[model samples]
Target: MTITPAQVRSALLARREIAIIDVRDEAPFAAAHPLFAAQIPLARIAVEAPWRLPRKDVTIAVYDDGEGLAGQAVAQLRELGFTRVEELEGGLGGWRAAGYELFEDVNSYSKAFGELVEHRRGTPSLPAGDVQALIDEKADIAILDARRFEEYATMSIPTGRSVPGAELVLRAPVAAPDPDTTIIVNCAGRTRSIIGAQSLINAGLPNRVFALRNGTIGWTLAGQHLEHGRQESIEVGDGVDEARARAREVAYRAGVRRIDAGQLADLEAESHRTLYRFDVRQPDVYAAGHLSGFRNAPGGQLVQETDHFAPVRGARIVLADDLGPRADMTASWLAQLGWDVLVLEGGFDGDLATGSDGAPPPRGPEGRYKRPYEGTDNPAAAMQAYLDWEYGLVAQLERDGTHGFFVI
Candidate 1:
């Protein structure tokens, strides 16, 4: 069986449960792939397929760029008991030949959505040089690093604290109590920074908020020094109540729906609709105790890498967090990004499951893609190319015309 690009596009528009998978390695897949295509690399099919496409009969379409991997992938999937696997009619070349668009880089659609958000909202930002000047002058600005703690520890702006994206709305009050203090958000590159800064702004924080334009990349390009091994992090203390109220309000304004335990069960009962249940709390908290059948996907990273977590574009997502603020805030962004997202309401005390938090096992280094936005040594040309691609995303999305993303 072979599926055409037009059929795949129709499936996406209809919000059907179809997985258009690229069976090539990371590099080439990153170079170009359909907007909704997920990279499952043929080498890691056995490890990723079973969990990624959990339903045995879910529609699965595999494609490659004339590398002849799709046939093998379809055969392997069938052997693994997948009942609805097929090859892409034209492969990668075929999709291009059929006049379909191909997106670049990992998490392409999510990054493109971020670009759309910025374009639509005109999110405020400060260039790296201006931010550095404020730091030198000891200005009353709180620089929040929106990347993971590990990434922040590797290298961060001189005095930036590790607040990671989803935690921004919940911790911003605690980090910068003064309404007059300017808050600057930075990530390794653009998406998280744009989302984080916009998150605080959307939550209606009293402080002036701005994305550190181009994030750490811009800082590096500006020849500013970065701190290594920094341990600064936000502590949720006296402001928890306020944070919860603010976060819930933000979520409400973004059109997110709240579902109790019974409703969630009902959603689960709908076997025909693909549902992703995620505990959007920190890893340590999730590892300590999480709801049964829920996987640990920290909210910030979930928003940053939606394509990896929920490749089924139109699937329903339920976010769980013991503290309501995180889930509510995370769900707000997801809703704006066009996900059918719901926040699970109530205490976290049903059949609590604890341990590794249900994350899929990691693939070996051989299957991993070296991201151009990571590390300090990425070539200047590569970094510039990345920014160029991001700058063009809003236009690309306009041309694609299939993304249902809306800014609130």
Candidate 2:
């Protein structure tokens, strides 16, 4: 069974559900792939396929450059009960011959959409040196690290607190109570930083906000010091009601819809369309208790890694939160990134699930991509290359016309 690259492109252009899986390890797939291709290495196809491909009936196009893995992958998937599995005809060469866009690095479109957002909005930012200067002078500033808590604990900018993405609007006002205080957001690389800072500005916060330019990569390249092993602490300011209101307004401006529990049940009943339900909150809070059937996807990382979480691009996403603002804020970004997203406004009061989802089985170090923005040890050349890739994404997105991103 096989599907042509043209067919895959048509499906994508029509906004239909399709899973284009690169049946190679992450490292090779990261080197180059179609804009929406998700990596599900041949070796772990069974394990990841069940998790990634929520519906066995959805169309699946497995491909490989020349590794001879696609046939086996198709077999494994069929044995696992996937009913509509097939190989991408001619594999990588097929996509290339068809003249479709190919993107490098992981989370390609999400990162590209971030670049597009910054490009269109002229999202404000500051260099690491300047941010360090503010810290030295004891300037009124609050730095928020928008990456995962584990990433922040590994390394962070001086005086930066782990505030993750979705928490920015919820916690920024609390972190910087004085309107005159500055709020600077940083992530491992540019995407989250830009999205985080812009989240505040979009919500119309009183404090001045800026993304840390090039994020931690630029911070290190500039010879600035980084702190490590700090515990995550975020200030809970006095205005939960105000923050909720601001987040709701932002989502509304971005065209995100709100749904109550009954509406969500209706969405769930639609088996023809894939629906992803996520609790966009911190892991700790989620482990304590989240609405039944909702997976924990902290708002910040969910936006940063939408491709990994939901590979079926046109699939609908419903974000759940007992707290008011997190779902709205997360939905705002997802909507802007061209996702069909909604906030669950009335589901938290029901029976809740407790404990972690348990960490996924690690693929280990064998075939992982060496992401430039991760860790503190990447070479200067790799870091610059990563930033250069990001710089050119706006043009790449333009070339790939399938992206539906819109900036507000």
Candidate 3:
């Protein structure tokens, strides 16, 4: 069976649960493809197909640019028990012939959505030089690093503390108790910094907040020094009550819903719809104990890397957490990003399962694309090109016109 480009475009506009996969390695797939296409090479179809597309009946369309791999992919997927599989009509050339736009780079749609959020909300930010001057003057500021603790330990701003993105809304009040203290959020690059700073703003925090523009890249370009091996962490204390209340309010405002165990079972029973159950908490805590059948995806990393976690654009996501604040805060962002997300309530009493940290196995080096935004050795030209691409995403998204994202 074959599906045309026009039919696929209509499905996307209708928000149908369809997976348009590019049957090629990351490097070539990143060079050019549809805005929402997920990369799963032909060779790894047997390994990745079952997990990535859990629902066997999901509409799956595989394509390649004149390479004879899509046929093999369809055969492999059928052998794996997929019920509805088809090849994309005309492949990459057909998409072009149908006058559809092709996007470049990995995680293109997620990056584009981030740009749209910034465009719609006008997220505030501060330059590296100005932030440095403030730190030098010993201003009343709390710098919260939104990257993972391991990434923060690698290199970070001089006075910044490790508070991952999902932790900001829950821990910001405790970290900067004084309403007068300025709160600054930073990540390795732009997207998380913008999202983190905006999260606090949306939560209605009283303190003045800003993102470190361009993050560590900006600091390095400005010739500023970054500290290593910082052990600072956000402490949970008497502020837990207030944090939970605030996070619940935010989730409500963002249109996130709550589901009981019975509803989750009903959701699982719908064979046509794909359902993903994730436990958003710290790795150590997840390893200690967790609810049955839920995989561990730390809340912060899940928001930062939504494309990797839920590649199907319109799947249903249910987040689980023993504590109220973490899952609520994470669900709020996911809802605003156009996902059908729910927070599972009251399910920690049964015999807890130990180890299912939802991280995917590492890909072989041959299939990976060397990202230009990572590492210190990237050329000035390449870095500038990456920033330029990000800056223009809002406009590109407008041209593409299938994203149903909104900022709350």
Candidate 4:
């Protein structure tokens, strides 16, 4: 079957259940995809699609940028038991030709919306050079690596502490006890950094806050040094514990549940029930060493994209995080979105496998992803033009009246 862009747009506008799959590589998909599309590269269809889109008969539409990949993907999906699979008419190029907005960057629309927030509200920011210099000087800066603990341990600015995304609100006061100290948040790329910084800002903190400019990718691109195997002691205080408890209550309000490791094991043992477990950390962290069966789905995008993360619509989901904030925060969003989401108990605290530390060495450069927004030879003008379009997205979100997003 073939689905037109207009029909897809209408389905999106009506809030219908349509899995708009972009069967392009990570790069182009990140460069641009339809506003509501989720990426499942054609190469990964046989392995990823069934788990991602578990409902065999759901309305699934696939697209590629005029390269005929979508047609190929539809055939593969059908063979894989996707009973209602269809290709997007004209593919991604057709959708673009229909004049619908295409979002860019990883979780592009959300990050673009965040940039728009910064543009409009002057969301605080710190330059990578300045933050790096402060770290070098050992100044009173609390560098919060907001991706996840494992991501922090994988490679981080020398002075960074692993503060996974959800824990910012709960751990902030303790991590930056000196009200005079500057607090900076970072992630592999942008979304978590923006959301983490804004989270602290919204909580009315006494300390100054800023997002690490462009996150870890920005730090790497700026020719900064990253440290690995540097472990720091973290102490959760009474105040922080109380804050975390309060955050849990907030999550309960949002519909999050807590389950122990044993229950998770029991659930995973059920062969008939499909369970999706996400470490809810950065990709680097997942590579470093995560729950044996869990995949990488960084907290911010996971919550922003519940449907893509757990396409079964009603599948049981277990999230793991050493720091509680991210799991609670993400589970809260999932519950509100009507998913059966729970945060797993117990943190992963073993040593590195490759190192004497007993932790497995992080997956190397081979595992690092090249974002779609970047181009090997694409001109500077196109990049700038792309940013200009992304810059106007928040206002468009308001006009379109979709997203169902509210600043927390």
Candidate 5:
């Protein structure tokens, strides 16, 4: 069986459930592919398929850029009991021939949605030099690094504390208790910074918030220095009551639903539908205890890498958290990005699982695009080019025309 590129676009535009699988190694898959193309390498198909593509009857379209791996992938899926499996008509070339854009980099759709959010919302931001001057003057401000703690510790703005994505709403109040204190959100690049700041603003935090524009890349290009070995992370504070109210309001605005255990069970029993259960909390917290069958997707990173976490674009996503607001805040963004998302209500105290999840199947560095912001030692030219590419994502998203994203 074969599915055409036009049909794929129609499905995405209509917000219909579809998994457009790219059965290439991560490196080559990252080089260029459709915005929603998910990399589930041919070697890992037997293992990853059951987990990522849980619904055997859900539509699955496999494609490759003339490498001829699509046929093998479809064959494997059929053997694995996937009833609706097919190759993309003509594969990746067919998409380009149909005049659809092949976006570069991993998590391409999530990155594009972030750009669209900023474009639609006019999310406020501060350039690296100005933010530096503010820090140098010892201004009444809190610099919240929205990247993971590991990334923040690797290299971050001087004195900035680690506050990953979903933690922005839950932790921002404690980190910047003074309503007058300026709150600066930044990541290694543009998307997280924008999404982090916007999340806070949408949550109605009283403090003035702005994304550190272009994030660490902007800092590097501006000749500003970044600090190393910073170990600070914001604590989950006593602001749960307020955070819950605010986060719920934001989620409501984005049309996210609240689902009880029974509702979730009904969802799980639907063999024809795909459902993803994710515990959106810090890794350590999730490892300590979380509802069974739910994978850990730290809230902020979940939004930053939604396509990776849930490859089926229209799959139902249930986000769980013991604490109040993390799941709600994460759900809000997912809903806005055209996802059918829900927050699992009060499941933390139930029978829970412990221990960290093993890493995903590794795809070696072959054709991967080395993101300029990952390490501290990238050449200046590479860093600038990455930012330039991001600046054009909004335009690309417009041209793609299948992203049903709306920013609140």
Candidate 6:
């Protein structure tokens, strides 16, 4: 079968669960690609297909950089057991010809959505230049890399410390003591930065918080350097612990529900439709400890970009947050947006094991499907306009009249 770029665009807009594979070499693929396309070079197709795409029935669309690689790769994928493989008509060239914006770098959509969130919600951010000055002087600025620990280990800002996305709520206080040190949160790209920074601001922390503008993207573009060695383990204090407890209470106040392991199993078994469970914690934390049958989706982005993560729109979403604030906040938004969202309680204390079978199931491969807005520079006008809308969301939430959400 052959699918046109228009058809692909429409399918994505409609939230169809199709795997978009860009069958081009790394260099060409890196030059430019769609916001949501995952780059798996045609050479690696056979080896990576069964793993990156475990589901044989998922509709797969393969595209090349104007070359005829797509058609050949599609055939190979079908031959190798992908039941519904098809070539994108006109290839990646066709997609660009259709006038859809091509996004570069990684996690573009999440990054773009981060920019959009800041634009729409007036989410505050700190300039990278100013942040660098603080670091240069060895000032009291705390640069928190809010990505997974593995990502931080791979690459990070020189003065930054690794604080996985999920730990932001509980660890933010410990990271900044006087409430006077500037706390800037960043991810490899944008969504986590916005979500992480906004998380602290939303939770009513005493410290002044801001997202690193454009995250590491801006950092790189500005000709800045990064640190590659192991990050020192941060010590948490009783104050931070108290703050976490209070944050959990706030989450409860915001209408989050908690279900035990048995109840979770009941929910899974009772539902006739397929349900997607998520551990709304950092990927590293998830790798270390998580409930069986749960996928990792850090909290802020889950709420910010619900359609990508839970494309079904109507699927039951059960989130597990070791820190209740993140889970509660995420569920509250998902519920408002018409998803049947729930929070699984008491699942991740490191000491607690979830599955009734006693041994934990092997974890699934992490979702590597890239989002849209990763690398392109945004125009100032568009960004400011986006932030304006986001600024009033709280009041809009009040006016939205969809307060079926309970705090927990």
Which candidate achieves the best TM-score against the true structure?
Answer: 2
lDDT of each: 0.87, 0.89, 0.86, 0.68, 0.89, 0.65
**What TM-score does each of the candidates earn?**
0.97, 0.98, 0.95, 0.69, 0.96, 0.66
Give me the displacement of residue 177 in model 1, in angstroms.
Answer: 0.4
Q: How accurate is candidate 6 locally (lDDT)?
A: 0.65
Ranking by TM-score: 2, 1, 5, 3, 4, 6
| lDDT-superior candidate, 1 or 2 | 2
Stretches of model 3 off by over 4 angstroms after superposition = 357-360
Clashes of each: 0, 0, 0, 11, 2, 21
Q: After superposition, how far is residue 364 of candidate 2 from its true place, in Å?
A: 1.5
**Model 3, residue pairs in steric clash:** none
lDDT of 6 by residue, 1-408 (tens): 788888776766555556678877655665677756776777777766664564566777788876778888988888988787888887877877887667554433444544544655577887678788878899878888877666677678876887765567677788787888888998755668886786677677888888888676667666677677657445445664565565555555555567787888887775344467887765556677776667777775566445445433234678887656557656654554445667787856546434332222332334232322233354544444333433443444343232222222
Order by lDDT, highest first: 2, 5, 1, 3, 4, 6
User: How big is the positional error of residue 166 in model 5, measured in Å on the Cα after superposition?
Assistant: 0.3
lDDT of 4 at 24: 76
lDDT per residue as tens, model 1, 341-408:
99999758666888875445777778567876787788887887888989999999888877888888
Measured over all alpha carbons after superposition, the RMSD of each candidate to the real structure, in angstroms, is 1.3, 1.1, 1.7, 6.5, 1.5, 7.9
Q: For residues 151-258, what per-residue lDDT tens digits would candidate 2 score against the true structure?
A: 999999988998989998888887888999999999988999999999999999988999999999999999889999978669667788999999999999999998
RMSD score of candidate 5 (Å): 1.5
Off by over 4 Å in 4: 116-122, 129-139, 148-155, 216-240, 248-324, 331-369, 372-401
